[model samples]
Target: MSTIIEQNQSNIITDNGLFPSNEVMLDLKNLKKVYPTPKGDYVVLEDLNLQIRKEEFVTIIGHSGCGKTTMLSMIAGLNPISGGRISVLGKQIKGPGPDRGVIFQAPSLMPWMTALQNVLLGVNQVFPHATKAQRNDIAKYYLQKVGLEDAFNKRASDLSQGMQQRVGIARAFAIKPKVLLLDEPFGMLDSLTRGELQDILIEIWNKEKITAVMITHDVDEAIFLADRVVMMTSGPKAKIGDILDIEFERPRTRKSVLEHDDYYKYRKHLIDFLEH
Candidate 1:
């Protein structure tokens, strides 16, 4: 069985109605992915194993064509694993569920919908039992948290890319998902905007304690946001290369983190890994 212990270790029931437990939030055991091609089977990932504790922020980094995003897709139930298993809170993932929320490279907002409406769409679907006022409050609270309070009424087509991404982030969080899957969510943004969104994401993660798995190519961003930085080998058959535990204390700032000795050490290590 994937679950080591299924009993409730804590009495806290989250707003999403899940009883938080002292257990691994996500577990991937011997996970593999393969695609059949005209040439033959193309292996993307194999013999991969990883475990994330409850509320942990883990980032996967590698060059293009690595299976980092594929791993996230499997965990999100968007793709089927050809081998092994993925378990969330000890239960195997079957398909897309409200327990997992995803933010992609593009905001993917509805052009005709206002920012608030776009956010409300996901919130309502995930929380159909919630009162209208309650759902409205949830939408407003998350939008404000992402610094999009003033853009509530603006249509998605009218908003800047950064603002639209803010709406995407708000929509993802409003659902109160136990796990947040980010596939290069800020990859298309400029450095300044990406940094801003990174800080906002950190604040939300800190507040909500949602387990997060983000795939990124940016070393600095990975160090800044992740509890553990997981590097993957370049793939025809990719697997974890190394795992680096970030020791920076919570409420981390870019300036303070950049000044730390271990920060540079970890950076150099990651660079060396990617180089050879």
Candidate 2:
């Protein structure tokens, strides 16, 4: 049976929620992804493994079609692994669960639902045992946390793409998931709005201390948000090229990220890998 261990080794709980092990939050071992096509079989990811410590923010960068999203999906349990092993919070991922929440390339809000309702759905589903009033309070708390209070009752269609993404972010975070799997969370936003949300996201992460894994093609974004950045090579079987430690001062501002001496050094390394 899988064991669940907190980072400190003091709060170990089992998979059944009793005996948590002291394992890292995420552990991927010799992970691989392959596909069977009529032409034969094509490998998309080759022996890709990653580990994430609790409360650490990690960003993944790669070329288009480089299996970055595929890797994220595997970690989120949205798709099955073709080979190897993955465990989150001491348990092997069997499928999607409340422990893992995903914000995809798009906001993916239900057009028919209001912003409040969209955010409400996740909490309600995950915390069914809680009282109606308890869930309501939790849902609204997260909605306002993302600055969507003014549009709380408005339909999702009424919100701009960036605003819709706020709801998605609120919803994913509302459950207090141990893992936040962000696949280009701000990819669709305008540059100004994207920058705004980046600050907000960092603030929330600091407060919540959630373990976050983000997939982005933007090197700057990776440097700004990640404690570590993992770069992947081009596909036909993409694999990790290099792992970088951001090593910036805590509570990093955008200016700090841009001004840091090693900022461009790491950025260039990622750019060289992607540009080549």
Candidate 3:
């Protein structure tokens, strides 16, 4: 049984032990992953366990080859788990579904299609029963939310990288997925562009309250975006080494966070883990 936790208004732990919420939106139980090599099986992750609550933002961070992306793939149903099980909202995750949406480092919009068309494609597939008007509305709303209302008709190839990624974000949210998976979604962007997209993502997340799991290498990004930062050890059989619950107040500004002592403490802790 999972232990219960008491949360203050700030979500800072004033008393009691560290425990995940009772309402688990996603559960990974003793999860394992192994790949068959020419010589033998190469295990990437073993005995991995984690529980995420509904609408919670969780980020996984570690050194390279730590299986962070691999773990995200498993959750996305893109890869098969060698052992253990993944449950999403009490349903077993056997394969991909409209319930989960993934955004990768690169914007995956089709070069042939316009931003509106690209977003509508996924929304249409996910909600096939909806009328054309409804689907159009859904796509446009998300696009507008991501600050791409004027660029709706722009082709993916014509748009800037950051703008293209905005379309991807719009497309993912248009599906109204229960869970959102992000794999270094801003890894290639400039610092200013990355910050802009991060703010957009945060705004969407706050409004939608969709459960999110992201894989990232940046400690500051993980700290700013995650409700909990899960640190993994190095692989060939990597597993979670630590889980740090972020105690920062919501509507968090970058300036405020940087000035806070707790932020540096959290940053230092994560950096130390990655270094040694």
The best candidate by lDDT is: 1
By TM-score, the best candidate is 3
lDDT for 75 in candidate 2 is: 90
Query: What TM-score would each prediction reach against the true structure?
Result: 0.91, 0.90, 0.92
lDDT of each: 0.89, 0.86, 0.88
What does the lDDT come to for candidate 3?
0.88
Candidate 2 root-mean-square deviation in Å: 5.1
The better-scoring model by lDDT among 1 and 2 is 1
Query: What overall lDDT, based on C-alpha atoms, would model 1 receive against the true structure?
Result: 0.89
Candidate 1 residues 182-210, lDDT tens each? Answer: 99999999999999999999988889989
Q: TM-score: which is higher, 1 or 3? A: 3
Q: Give a tens-digit lDDT track for model 2, residues 1-276.
A: 122223344655434342234446887768899899999999999887677877889999988899999999999999899998889876789988879999988999999999989988899999989999999899898888888888989999999998999899899999999999999999988899999889888887888989999999778999999999998888978888889988897788999889888988988888887787
Clashing pairs in 2: 4-20, 4-21, 5-21, 5-22, 12-20, 13-19, 13-20, 14-19, 14-20
Decreasing TM-score order of the candidates: 3, 1, 2
Q: What is the C-alpha lDDT profile of model 3 across 122-163, one tens digit per residue?
A: 999998999999999999999999999898898889999999
